[model samples]
Target: MSWFKQGLCFLPVFLVIWSSSTFIVTYLIALFRHDVDIIFPYISDTGANPPESCIFGLMTFISACAGTATIYARYKYVEKLSEDPKVVNPRLNKTAFLFGMLSCLGMCIVATFQETTVTVIHDIGALLFFVTGVLYIILQSVLSHRAYPFGSSMFVCRVRSGVAILAFLAFFPTVICAFFVTQTTLHRDKGDTDYPYHIASAVCEWIVAFSFICFFLTYIDDFKIFTLRVRVECKE
Candidate 1:
């Protein structure tokens, strides 16, 4: 592959790793803060916190770039795999990739509208990120059943796909339960947060984030055959 193609191939990969890492790091730092309760506060709350907010918001923007790159890579990878035309649907891959892009866009929006600063936009972004992202997961799960032009491990694909599907399937009920329970606490008690509901939502959000990361990790195996390497000799 040319240098440009090589860059394209790895852009999403690197961005994903960085974004995921930054998210974890920011959360860890925010967890120690006295104002926020690690167990119940949403991930977005971390982004709302003063100092850590910068890091979380930056990571979210990076995630959007990663998503754009992923969309490009997905199209190219699927196109390459579909050259034979006899097996596989390029269209399906394209659709999944589009969904992934929208998911990323949602993250960007959430970052732009931090929870404390603007709850409505942030909530909209959260819903968009989760719902469309899960749809992408489901589409990719279906695609895994088909054969790739380049070699693919059915076992790995199946397992990853299954996990994505199951986690996504669980996200809905988990969020709904959390919402109702949390709302009751907010309205009935007025001051006390429903720890159970808050904790549940936070957990579900983490699971969904994990699933998103895992789906992208599968790309590492797929990109294994494609490499960008440079050799340098010192003084010899």
Candidate 2:
């Protein structure tokens, strides 16, 4: 295979690095500026200020684009395996694609709307991203299990399943704790009454985000073997 063709495998790798770097960079910026406290802050909190917010928005937008492409490529990969015309898996694969796109769209919304300024909309976007993102992974795991012989390895399937389970386990605590805490500003001081709840939610948020990133890393090997192509034909 051509180098460029094999490069598709790097999409997930790029996403994992890019998105994680976004969070780390923004957190460091916020920390250095003393805009946020030393304790854990929501991922959005790290990017709620001026310069960091701008960087957060731009990097997150890039992440969304990369994520969209990765999801679509995985969808096409499954469609290729469902070569049997009678197989009903294509419909399920399409559903997974829709969920993945919606998750990416949510990331776009989060990137565009700063949590401190438009908290409701930002929270909505976060909710959409987390909820739909989890659903997308669960569906893909199912498809991976079904496509065992034709596509993914048993090891990859099991790994994806494990990640999906971890993401699901983290999802509820993130949401529940977030509700218990009240958002007054971008940063939360340890002295705040809701500090415990805030920390819990923040930690869980990080877990879910990293889980999503880790799940994508499994795609590298799968993408290495397949070459996606476009065919053109003239009909008389």
Candidate 3:
């Protein structure tokens, strides 16, 4: 029982829950501190706020750690399940796992440098994080489709694939638009924060975020099997 409990702490689910909770709390605090417009401001703005900077800084570090653990756990979990008879035909792609790990590293880089303090470094991190992140999602979606071809999970895998593509579609174009809009605004008036296109970009970014998050839900079905293994081992 103790071993089961201990092992549960290392699951991807645990890490994701921890990271998500930290982010939610940090965001709420930042929202309260700057209660102007929550939906329109980019996610980075919450972390960049003066009052919540320190807390969100720590939150990013925690997220980096959790991201690392989550990717590793997810790889191991899926790899193991691929060998099961229930799987249609398993193909374990180490390349996908490697790319996923790189995404986590990108996340760490983003967390280490604040956007407000170091714009260039932060932009690079964000670039790596999102580009590689969406790549990982697409690759994993392919891997999942291969892993779960005809089971109940197969449908979820397809859904994940769709969501991943949606995230990519929503992210890249909006990113270009946002960059162009911000640049145009800066050139026009340094003091103006009234760029309507910026808010549009923020909204699209949130859409991308939601889609990416849903893409990860494909693994939720595996949690039961993993947790069951823990309980059985503990029982034995």
Top-TM-score candidate index: 2
State the displacement of the C-alpha of residue 110, model 2, in Å, after optimal TM-score superposition. Answer: 0.3
lDDT of 1 at 127: 88
* Residues 168-201, model 1: lDDT tens digits: 7768865785665535211123255565666666
Clashes of 1: 0
Candidate 2 weakest lDDT stretch, 10 residues: 1-10
Superposition-based RMSD of candidate 3 using all C-alpha atoms, in angstroms? 5.8
Off by over 4 Å in 2: 1-7, 85-88, 230-236
The per-model lDDT (C-alpha) reads 0.71, 0.89, 0.64
**Cα lDDT, model 1, residue 134:** 91
Ten-residue stretch with the least lDDT total in model 3 = 182-191
Candidate 1, position 96, lDDT: 83
Error of 3 at 188 (Å): 14
Residues forming the 10-long window of minimal summed lDDT in candidate 1: 182-191
Return the clash pairs for model 1, or none. Answer: none
Q: What is the lDDT of residue 154 in candidate 1?
A: 81
